[model samples]
Target: MSKFKKKAEVKQEIPTSSMPDVVFMLLFFFMVTTEMRKSSIEVKQQIPKAAQLRKLERKTLVANLYIGQPTEAKFGTEEKIQANDAFISTEDIIRWVNEEKSKLAEAEREQLTIAIKGDKDAKRGIIADVETELRKGNARKVLYTAADNSNARKN
Candidate 1:
């Protein structure tokens, strides 16, 4: 009984609900807006080992070619050609290399590198063709695709 009831009165109100709904809405929003990562292509080729394998950070061009033994269909069966018959066409190589070179020129990008992905069973001559085309395109750096250790052990 001091002058006017001393301290009036202190009141506190607890939240009834709605907090769970708010949290659920926020979680759903984030889940809906989240971005899904794209899948990367598998590198399918055999690379020759080197004592010094330097890693390159940037790749300006990627050339994909399918080189394999020619198959001839006979009596509903596929007949594989001999080793000497395996080859990649020269015209195709030239076209792909030129395309990559033009891409670099159009983008005005420097420090261009060429990445060649070829079939593992492809002949050396086919790889040589790719290299020659790259040289003509004036590509200074080159990277070759290779099979992983597990895949190598399988073969």
Candidate 2:
């Protein structure tokens, strides 16, 4: 009975040294696979619905420009242009485009496209102004984003 008790006292414990390694692997996997939002949108933009819409193949090559009314009442109900997280004037569009263009490589400059997400009720003149600024900055590639209206009848 003493010998049996001694054998029982000598117990083998499962090693947990690799537990941290396993946890770290899972953390790394999620970090690599997750798509983080690059910028926070401050404006409220209800993009127009469209029957046909195509997704951008490369997210890195796209810069988002949001146009809509301010989400907060203090900012007024008038429509505005938002670049990154702040409201930008039409005159500032040129500067914003240049800044974004500078971030890209020379070869990639031509490939970079500005994705304009304007509200359905926003003024068309503002859209045209944004386009003109884009051209002035030598960033001519522009993409207008619209919500997919999959239920719409095809002609």
Scored by lDDT, the top model is 2
- Clashing pairs in model 1, backbone N/Cα/C closer than 3 A: none
Which residue pairs clash in candidate 2?
none
**Model 2, 133: alpha-carbon shift in Å?**
1.3
Q: Worst lDDT window (10 residues) for model 2?
A: 146-155
User: lDDT score of model 1?
Assistant: 0.52
Cα distance off (Å), candidate 2, residue 123: 1.4
Off by over 4 Å in 2: 1-34
Give the alpha-carbon lDDT of every model: 0.52, 0.86
Model 2 has a clash total of 0
lDDT by residue for model 1 (17-67), tens: 988999999999999998573422232234443333445576434434444
Q: In candidate 2, what are the lDDT values of residues 22-108, reduced to their tens digit?
A: 999999999999978667777887889887778888888888899988888999988889988788998898888878878988888
